[model samples]
Target chain A: MSFTTPTIDWAAFAPIIIVLGAGAAGILVEAFVKTPATRRTVQLALSLAALVASLGVIIAQWAALDGAGTVVMSGMATVDRQALAWMAILLVFGLLSMLLFASRDGGGAFTELGATAPGSVEEKLARRAGLQLTEVYPLALFAVGGMMLFTCVTDLVFLFVALEVFSLPLYLLVALARRRRYLSHEAALKYFILGAFSSAIYLFGVALVYGATTVTDVNMIGTAIVNLADADPLLLAGAVMIIVGFMFKIGAVPFHSWVPDAYQGAPTAVTAFMGAATKAAATAALVRVMFVAFAPLEWELSWLVWAVAIASMVYGTVVALVQTDIKRMLAYSGVAHAGFILVAFAGLEGEALTALPFYLLAYGLATIGAFAVVSQVRERAEDGGVGAEAVRLGQWAGLGKRSPLLAGSMALFLLSFAGIPMTAGFIGKFEAFSAAIAGGAWPLVLIAVLASAVAAFFYVRLIVLMFFTDAPEGAEETIAIEDGALTRVVIYVTAAAVLVLGILPSGVLNLFADASVLLVSVGG
Target chain B: MNPMNYVILAAILFSIGAAAVLLRRNAIVAFMGVELMLNAANLALVAFSRIHGELDGQIMAFFVMVVAAAEVVVGLAIIIAVFRARQTISLDEPAELKG
Candidate 1:
């Protein structure tokens, strides 16, 4: 082997560069800007600008994704189109979340039924009375940027850094809620500890892989392992360990214990961020490892992953069926969804790999929209104030009779979760299951379909609660909000996506096929 | 120098860490155990890097250490906050948010 100087594609890395600049700018704005409110505005604007730039880069790359666009950075990282696309999606998700958090109580019901038109003196006065905090935008963007980088990271070091870059801010995100501070605090603690443990396991796996194969560049490690497969015990141990760590992050059953508490306790906004983006990052990283690096040993590892997939599916769906609190139920549903997504990776077949990214997008959008709605609906207590507790199904008993639109949207999301035909979940589950079947994984595919049915029961139950079940006595029937434009937009767009993708999944499926399947013929 | 020895030591250390994560109740203790596992991994990585005469793995190990350090600070701070909130660090007792 000869030593060579590394080359970088700065243009390809434009999104990341822009985000880092925004993060720096955010810190500056935070320090110099006097009011937290004013600083939040500037910081959020900067973050949104960074996300917009990320979107632009993604579009540019999508226009030119014919070849594997590798911007090798000192032989450490690459700026590829697949990663850029995932990042672009992440930034857009971040932007939408920021929009929801941007408005002053626009989501809270005090801001809802309490005011008239903005031009009215009453509305203006109410606005002047309270200062809303929306500083989560910059932190969210930095986290999004880190996740974007996480998807594209070609080297081991970049991978770990990207993981932490996103993880740290997320801990704070959990603790930011106003109503359920204790729950948030506990959730943050559990999440932080579990996350740290998983990170450690991941690093340990990397170390063993390094020790056995004596290489760290994933491409190099894969090659060395292929040659040493019969001789290297360390490589085998390391591979299995790394897979376990990733399985935990993606909430594969048995390692999924923290998800429900974390999701339920964290603010709904933060839950959406973790529910969607974390899965994307974990799935992307796993694909890069499984398909790109260790594609050779697919036959052996596929079984382990398949077992996990089946377990996750059954566990998530069955547990969700019995949950009363909406958030905890959604958490279980997220777990089951992770299983469905992982089922797409039960083998190294090209079709299966393609389904992986598409499944993430479908699941991300659905979970994000669901959380957005959860954040929107408010219930007023006896003292005459509204908050998140108003989001319960009991309070939502007469929702259809009150605000038919919100009820209908909630119904669509529920139907989507059930993978009903004409929803994105349907398409996502179909493609993932079909991919697994194509890979000759019939039994696991059957189990996945069965688990979907189980999940459907809970999803349908929610629909019944929204449409058929009568409101409990003393419960609020109307959905009140302080601000809700962004939530409504997210709800409708995600619902429409579910329907469109369900009705005609072929287009997105084809796009997924065209996208790099995280399989880059490494040893060639 | 026996490579098997290095690999064995890493494995033993990792198992100890895993046991700690599973058996310990204190969040901070579990965190420390996780750190030990991480260090064991770093040791294996460097050892393997030296054996292979490769700089790539060594470089990667450096990055892993940086991430591990960051995770510790943030993780410890979060644990401290929770302790203050609930006056307990035992994972078994923090069912206040459980489903």
Candidate 2:
């Protein structure tokens, strides 16, 4: 018997290939490069180059493929404007985060020797010698590749593979922080156990969905459901399980127990990257599954989405009010932002399609910038070696007087998080609420507005503490600035983008609107 | 016996695995629960493939095994590291990162 081979389009798959290749090359560099210093430089350069190269390729492919919606490997993967837009957004964030990752003179944010016990003589010696773990570069690249693939895959099995690809690296990265090693390790354990559990549930859901429909391709399943006279309860059960998996990734309430711990425990650079990129990637998949594959069941499933949105908003906002730690507070704020974005998801219509990507972009920039500022504000020790970040809310009082630029930037990001009028968060909230309103989700929008007002109190409280309060005695220079050009670039660029995207939103809004057309079927 | 029996068996196994994960305190045992859950999904896939007269489900089962193996490597590495540091494999002991 003659075998017919399925034709593969390499050009359509270039961005994923380049990023994964860079990750592999980084591993090789670690093995071959004798000097740790050289390996560190090489890995950082390689990661940045990979991200930039992928961005360039995405732009090149955008014009001819814009709105074309081509399915590359039969039904395995689809390349469309929606996937392309998300890919571009993820790559930009990845590049900025790498700069944050590699921005320090004394071996940066990661532990010099990750396997060494924290506070041991070996660890102290490694720190004094300024050893570095260049492996984080490759791990991050793999995560980026997985996230990019996650946004575009049409097959359920491929989606699971992509989910694991990104998650495993992030679990390891969360454990690599230089200080608070126990906390980091604990967070890593919790994240891994829960994350794997979620994936298993997701896979079980996949099996049942496949069993009910006898198909693995999302579009095929959608088609089968459309043809069936009565919808199977098994299909609905599978859908809810899949939604839970996505919610876990996005850090929505009930499934969000890991968010604050992981955020507080990880190196700030890693937190910046994962917070923004994971939300974008998971939201992309959620939208694809809901709008493209499960559209017919919108009425039955919309209530589930609404309950999650409201729960996340109310819980995140109320809990954040009492958090003394800035990272934990930001983590809760992330939960609330996830809820706001879920407002768009609950709409599950053409209007939501327009609002979701723009909201992710605005939210991502503010988050990365805020975390970059956090990374710089460290506690000054007697030995002149940088201590861990002073994250307690009390430590931040009178920060405005100490460093006007950093504190001002932090305030800008916080305002954006609060949905202030001149920040991107405002536009994001406005678009999301309007979309929900148009989709007849007015009550959800009203609750969201009330939640936002409640959330504003904490953000303003922090701002007040910074600018109005006096520095608690002799704590003037305790908040040491780790001054790095790369970190500053990350802060300035995101802060500027937040303001620009807020005021002159038309340009980016039109771009998002153009890329909002999702292809449900192969080559639609 | 009917092929549907295998599917029912798989479902029972999956529920037991889920219960173990929720109820168990030991990190390794909880991890084992995840493995059991994955294996149940594999069993279901194989049974369903037979009923459907296709190789797709069998192929997916193989993929699941490879992914599961990789997961064990990472999971064990993490558990061992935590155990070494704290001298306990119990997840309940590490209450350092709450709320």
Candidate 3:
């Protein structure tokens, strides 16, 4: 028998190739470059260039993808408006977060000597000599590349691969904090174990689906469901398991045990990047799986989605109300935001699709901005050196008196998180609720509204603590500010974007509406 | 000899792995639990491929193996880091950041 190779479309695959290729080259730089300072500069420059270049390609392809979509690489990936929108968001988030990573207040966010024990002489010596783990740049690029692929893959196999590719880097990055190595390492271990466990279940689900449907391609799975005479129990079980995997990534209830710890332990920069980008990537993939591959089973899956959404909202809000650590609070708040995005899935139509990407963009911008503010506020060491981030809510007392600009930005982000009027979060909530209502899911929206109200209390509490409260008596630990141009740019851009998107959402709303359609088939 | 039996055995192995992950206190053993689960998935894939009369499932099993291998590399590095820091591989030791 003669075999013919399938024709490949390299142009459709350029964005992923460029990002991953740059990541591999970055690894080479880490090995060959002698000086840590020069290696960091090279890595930072290459990473920014790669992300910006990918964004350029995505924009150039955006207008061309008007109708159904292009299926490339023998049906492994689909290049369409939905994928393009997520790619743009991920690339933008990557570029902005790279700024946060490269920003240095001497120690920056990453450990100087990751392999050395936390308080050992070798660690201190390495710190004194000013060593930096420039390897983080390549890991971030790898994660970004995986996220881009996660949103666009057309097959379950590719889905699993993308899921792991993104996850492994994050697992490593979570452990690289310059301070609090113990907590960081522990968090990484928990995240790795739990993440791997969830993915295995997802793979098993894929096996069951293949057994029931006789196909591995997601589009074919959808077709198989319609072509089959009856819905197999195995098929439903498989779907739920696959969704369990996605929920773990999204940080929904029951699967959200990892979020708070990981968020609290990871360096602020990594948390900011992962919080904004990972949720977007997972939500994009979830929408494709639910809308494109499992559209026919909407009636069966609706209740599961609603249950997870409601539980996530309630649990996230209630738990966040009691959190003392700012990062942990933000992590719980992120859980609630994930629920809000999932609520749109209650409406399994184009409207929900339109709402999610827009909501992700709005939420992502505010999150990255808030974390940038978190990174700026440092603990003052005895020798006048800058320590780890000041994470305790009490530590933020009277911050407005010292750094009004930083306090104001954090307050703005909190307002956005609360979905208050005149912020991007408000617009995000409006579209999500409206879409759910249109789908006849008003009860879920009502529950969501109540959770948002409860969530608003916690966010407002932080705001009040920052602006209104006096520094407690003998609270000698002052909040030290590290001036970095990179972080300053991130803060200003995010703050301004939040206000602009809040004020004029029509332009982006229309884009999301137009790009909501999924091109889901084996053929282009 | 039947493929259905092999699928059942894989399911049992997967359950054990899940139990180990949930109940084990040792980080290394917990990690081994995850590895077991991945291998179980590979087993199911091969069994399913045999019944379906196609090689796609077998190919998927290969991919799973490679992924599992990579995961082991990363997982071990993390476990080693944790062990060096605390002088223990027990999951219960690190209790600094908890609600």
TM-score of chain B alone in model 2: 0.96
Full candidate order by DockQ, most accurate first = 3, 2, 1
**Candidate with more favorable, higher DockQ: 2 or 3:** 3
Off by over 4 Å in 1: A1-5, A106-135, A229-231, A477-483, A504-506, A517-524, B1-3
Ranking by TM-score: 3, 2, 1
Top of the candidates by lDDT = 3
Give the lowest summed-lDDT range of ten residues in model 3 chain A. Answer: A66-75
Each candidate's lDDT (Cα)? 0.73, 0.88, 0.90
Tell me the DockQ of each model, to 2 decimals.
0.49, 0.73, 0.82
For model 3, the docking class works out as: high
lDDT of 2 by residue, B1-99 (tens): 678789889989999998999999999999999999999988988888888889899999999999989888998888887887788989899988777
Please list the residue runs of candidate 3 whose C-alpha ends up more than 4 Å from where it truly belongs after superposition. A474-477
| Tens-digit lDDT track of model 2 for A38-91 | 988999999999999999999888877745567778778888888889999999
Worst 10 residues of 2 chain A by lDDT: A515-524
**Clashing residue pairs found in predicted model 3:** none
**Number of clashes in model 1?**
10
